[model samples]
Target: MDIKDGKIKIAYLSQVPAPYRERMHELIHQDHQFSYDVIYCAKLEPNRKWELEYGNYKMHFLTDVAKTFRHNNTNVWALLKKLNPNVLIITAFKPTMLYGVIWCLLNGRKIIVYNDGTFNSEKSISMIQKQIRKFVYWVASSFMAPSKGTNDLYNSYGVGNDKIFRSCLCVDNSVFDNLPVRDREFTIMFSGQIIERKLPLFFANIAIELSKKIPGFKALIIGDGEQREEMIERLKQNNVDFEFTGFLDQKILPKYYSRAKLFLFTTKHDEWGIVANEACASGTPVITSVDAGAANDLIIHNINGYILPINVNIWVEHILKLLGNDNLYNEFSINALAMVAAYNHQQAAGGLVDAVNYALAEKNKSTQSNTITA
Candidate 1:
């Protein structure tokens, strides 16, 4: 239990090597509080197009022999056994990770469940699935959450507030600073996959409606997916001035954010939208859906931006209001940057360390109690 004597060995199991997560893990390694190892199920998920570089921390990728795998495979068990870490952090709930949880239970290793799911996003869970999560909740030593909504989710599952830790979902804020200023050519922007859940068509509809009121209104659409062609067709038919940039890399993505007047996020359901952080860091206001998990923590209603339900007419009205008033737009933009300042890589790393230390101490107490009874 004495950290000065020896470091805690931790195995952080995740789905992919996302750039934002790698940044946080790099900071955790620099802290030198624990021997941290990041174990990824795969190098990248099929749906993602991020170009990732591994960080300074120890990383292990489970071999996915199956050519068509969803998230994980059975190889996690062998790698976990070989690592034999003192603590295990579970971020995904695939069968492989479920088995890993069982393995940790048998070996008496502490398990911390890191989740981003909110009450709104998980409202439609079947009874059997809810029971499964309830079991996992009982077994986990502690929980790590990003927002108040996620905290409410754990509380609803009967997990006490004391056991929940805050590790805000964040990105590297440095990348978004001091960029070359460009003309705000695009009046509105939508940055995410063009699939059904992201509501790309809804964004197009809003843009079409706005163009009718504002002269020469232009929109910027970033990302590509199965529904890209259909969304593009809709915009073209309505004579909406828009440019579609398909799947931008993380490095140059901020350039577009800087050139846009506002960001529109209309996801049907999202645990956390890191894009909201990027837009705010660039001093751009966000108009996001209430269903997004970040709405509760990142976006302050009427301060930084407005969080409203997914309705075309309502969204169009807000967009016109913000664009028409220069003073109000400047106020929202300034407030946005101020609000997102706390969400950075260093703060996220600190939160993770606090949770790890707490879990280790609780596990030690449980061990001592069992020994005394024996």
Candidate 2:
């Protein structure tokens, strides 16, 4: 390992160069003790026209010899070998990560994983996939999970407790928190893709019900999707008053979050929801299902918002209750802003730094013990 200018060299392999991940890099670079480079497989999402605002960071791109998430394997070894980091981090167990871990194992590099999945998702895993991931865990040095479900996932795979570090996800909260405040409007908001999995159609139904129950209620749907036409058709049929703001960039979200009285995210299942975090930062109460991993972290039931099972009736009851009670909504709104103080990108990035140091220290102790024996 090489220490240049007394800084620990760390390399991170990212599936995508997200704004949040770039923010994480900035937070990591802020520490004088650490120097980092991010290697990305793709600059943009594959097979999608959804272009995200990119960041200028110390980053590298690998030649994606194959082009797909499930099977794409890029030429990552050359740069990794040259960098020769003290610790290497991969974001998932995909082909690129598999390639990364193999190279790390060959070079005896310490490995930390930031999986995009949670253990409690109940997603069907084939036996081969399970065995493959088990081997992946076997070679990994430490894991950084974003949610409790992810921590449980690592445990289910037999990873030791000492080898796990929480905080797999975070957004740089400064942008959302520092946004110019807006007056609360009689509107409910949902920000995400309009996919079947995201259930924007379900959101349309909720919007219809909400508008009918609450006076002057309007729906603010901020996103684009395959189900956009479907959602619009349903909205028209239900005679719901809604505004479909075509997909806005991350930077543009705070204003939408600011004016909305309540933020509703009705997804089938997600490891975590950054929108919920954004809502919390903007001081808007969140109404998300417990299926979202960020629900528990960002929202205390009936405090910042309500978290119930993905049941439409239950969601309507809680939302109507919040809307009907001005005092309760204000209380939740205030609590939302207060609770997000600890869940920022800097804090999440710091957890990664801790993981790197812990792994390296363990390696150093093992080496010393071996030397003494010799």
Say which candidate scores most in TM-score. 1
- For candidate 1, lDDT tens digit of each residue in 261-308? 889988988999999998998889999988888996899889989999
Model 2: lDDT of residue 330: 80
Give a tens-digit lDDT track for model 2, residues 119-218.
7574577888888888888877777877777887888888877777766466655666423223666478888888888888778878888768877777
**What is model 2's C-alpha RMSD?**
5.2
**Each model's TM-score?**
0.92, 0.90
- Model 1: what TM-score? 0.92
Off by over 4 Å in 2: 47-56, 63-67, 177-182, 363-374
Name the lDDT value of residue 143 in candidate 2: 78
User: Which RMSD values do the candidates have, in order?
Assistant: 5.2, 5.2
Reference-based lDDT, residue 181, model 1:
24
Shift of residue 338 alpha carbon in model 2, Å: 1.4
Q: Rate the local accuracy (lDDT) of all candidates.
A: 0.82, 0.75
Superposed Cα deviation of residue 372, candidate 1 (Å): 36
| Cα misplacement distance, residue 153 of candidate 2 (Å) | 1.4
